[model samples]
Target: MLKTLGFAIICLLLFGRCAQQVSPTGGKKDSIPPNLIQSIPLNKTLNFKENRVELFFDEYVVVDNITQKLVITPEADNPYSYRLNGTSIVLNFKKQFQDSTTYTLNFGDAIKDFAERNPAKNLKLVFSTGSSLDSGRVYGMVKDVQTNKPLFDALVGLYNPTDTLNPAKQKPFYFSRTDSSGVFSIENVQTRNYTMIAIDDKNRNMLFNAKDERIGFLSKPISAGVDSVSYNILMALSDNTPLKVQRTLPKVNNYTVVFSKPIEKVKVTFMNKDSLPYMIENGEQIKFFNVQPHSDTTLVKLSVTDSLETSTEFDQKIAFQAPRGKERQKDQFTISSRPENNRPLANSFSYRLIFNKPVQTIEDSKIELITDSLTHETLKNFKSTWNETHNELTIEGKSFAKDTIKWEIPKGSVISVEGDTLARTLIKHPVLNEEDFGILRGKVIGADTSKLYKHFIIELMDDQYKVIDRQYSSPYNFIHIPQGKYFLRLILDLNDNKRWDTGQVNKGIQPEPIIYLPEKTLIKSNFELNDINITLPKAP
Candidate 1:
């Protein structure tokens, strides 16, 4: 009986082990297929007379979308002549090869296996039907023109300027991709004068659509021959037609007119004609205004008035209903601190004033600063600057070593730029501190004195890659940033404007170039800043 019991126990243990081995709880092993072993005629071969080329791999590999991935440089008359039969990629030429010219076939991120879909990065083949292959190459870096930091994987291409073919309809004769350092290389280029363009393929279509895409280009033709060429490509927004307003919103008691571009001039007028209540505009950006109350419901129409006295009318209508509850009203002027803790000694601290309505201007005499201890009376001479873009007032003065400081803005003391009087009561605060403060500083250099970037942007980023601070300056301007570990970035202001612009698709305009600082270096905290020198590259 004891022997039988021992045997039963052994059988149960064996059954449990077998069940665990085959159960879903057991982890599965990852499988790696095979790599491409070799190809006939080799890669980058020159002076080839054969009409057909073959590629061979070690394992049973599958080819992915060969049509989109394979690009023939010095572009072939018929680019769609290649096919994959089983494990081999075959290229067939419909016409005779060009004499004494080199060609490159770049398979950009498209070569993958059948089973695992493993991609072969930058798989390219070069050959010539002539005596020698074109050995010229162009090397350069790409970055966000504004941030001055490297932009990886940006598409860089070369085109014949005289072709006159739309960039969207045709493929580039030569192309390459930017690396992690924002560096790109286009090799085996022929001897010719060509135009070079860098594009951020946001749509992955390998073309520059002005309205929806961003592009950068050399203003002049580039000569490439026997030696390698080096150039930096700055991406910029294309200047297509201005943005159009899509839809109007007056139903939620809020109306918005979206534009295809930033509005240069805006004039809003409410009109009642032919029983239609409409708001007309002579601008690209959407404008919002309070609507007049009419009974329980308000009806309104929207129209865009152009400079040429033409109006583009919309078919949609807007309606606003009365609120159900009692409305709450507060003071028109609201005062806030950047570092809300009232820590006076901190560097990032600042006093911000937001008006309920747009004020015509602010008067310098009505603003006042006081100290908590009452012993320091020299705080009255504070400098104030207003930012029209965000509609905020900035007041800067003597630094405080303590945790809090007193502030006073008396009524009728501040006047607007339009000479309008501020009638709100005085705003007084007891304590403000240093944790509410920040500083930024940098230096700008130019390719030459005459070619300085006029309106540039300097951005400071936190560790998580968020833009925590931003400042705009003219050429050779310095900025003070708050105390923090920041990644410094810069954008070249191409049009002498301080704002960043987007691209236009239908007009074939590319977006402006944005450059970023190298990731190897970053701005640190708590020290007298040094000049971050940036040298702008001349347009080719």
Candidate 2:
């Protein structure tokens, strides 16, 4: 009995200790990357003639994704093969080194410690089969043209001026990838004239794929021998692919056609113009509604023009079907106000009511406007108008007094298409005083006179870069703006398209330039700011 009791007590004590969950405290993590302690045929070796090279690290290291991370400048026909042995990496050359030429082997983030996987940064080996290494270097940054944001990991390349092959067809002669700051440096250059280009390589392939990649170029070839030879590249989606129809989806109530890319303009027509359907364009899809249901297929012609100004016309056969079962149920009629509920309205702005479908009839007697939630007035004096689609109604008072107003819309007051009636609604709008606004006026000094004749879309943006008000002409004059901190932006309408055109790659045109006022403009209540001048960068 004594032995059994002792065994039970010992088992309970062991189980309790295990259940207490004691965590082993290791002192500190090994955050340091493996250091290169030694190298065979040491770095920057002159007249390097060895067929093999070895790199020894302080700790056991692993080579990761060497095929993608490794690069050899002045590309060779037969590159080296890499192998790992214990705490070292070996490179065996497959061919003899070129005579009197400099070479660079870059192992970008490929060598890391075996335990923690901490990568070794800036692992590059430079040598020459000649007496000295090349002293030329090219440094630059890559940024997005539209947003002016740094593009990380973009590939910058150099090519011989006489090279006939484009970036899409051939890899660059010398290339380097941009770091986190969008900066890239290609050292050991030959100090010759070369054409330079940068691309946001999505596929990790050195070759630029025009179908998806964004590319940028300098207007002239650069001489690498010049002091401080730096160039900034502006990258844009230089897609010049011709627009093609991908597929056509015809449904019971609507017909949709999908294209390979988003189109700028689209037109859908039939043999009988009288039977034209209402068309709506949403990016890459063109939707058609109200096409009379027919038992036989109808030939529909579609013409679309993409952003590149490439136009294509095609014919498709579609059969329209009738709605069945639950599909026949009428869509719920809805109306929403612009200022929403209990929101303040600006004086220059008009109160609007948007409906789901086109409105047919409006009963003026059922609509009432209450001033200060007290005095009731008829809307006969208020000017009301409908938008082109006849689905939005705008109500504007000839002149609004600084006061709160309530709008009461009774059910069935407004009738829309398909015999839909508006629901009851109560909304409030307040007309603010003139003292609550401010004015901003500025002159753009370097806007091209020719392009200004076309127009400059001047915008007044809030602190968050959201446009508050816009004007077409320059010497921006923005009035009746709420008091806030703001800035100015100018969209150069080079093509007079009334929009910023991100250039056409096939035409070799750069995007229309955009300029922003450097300093933030603060608008004080009832204050007018002036004398803010801006200069546009010279056209490329």
Q: List the RMSD of every prediction in angstroms.
A: 8.5, 5.0
> Please, what are the lDDT tens digits per residue for candidate 2 over residues 316-335?
66665556667445557677
lDDT, candidate 1, 1-540, per-residue tens: 999999999999999788744435545542554455677677756677777777776555566677776777777776446777777777787766677878787776566666557666557778887877787888888866545567888888888876465566655788888899999988888777777878777776788766555567666678876675678766655544433566555533334566554345443333433121222233454434333443333233445444322345544333444445585222243444553424333333455665433455455554555454453433245666665433456666564435345555556665432233455543334343323434445565653463455567766677555776566653333234445566666666567566555543333444555566665344334344556666555665
The global C-alpha lDDT for each of the candidates, from Candidate 1 onward, is: 0.58, 0.76
- Alpha carbon deviation, residue 298, candidate 1 (Å): 14
- Candidate 2 TM-score, true structure as reference: 0.79
Ten-residue segment with the worst summed lDDT in candidate 1?
273-282
Best candidate per TM-score, number? 2
Residue 32, model 1: Cα distance from true site in angstroms: 7.5
Query: Roughly what TM-score does model 1 have, to 2 decimal places?
Result: 0.60
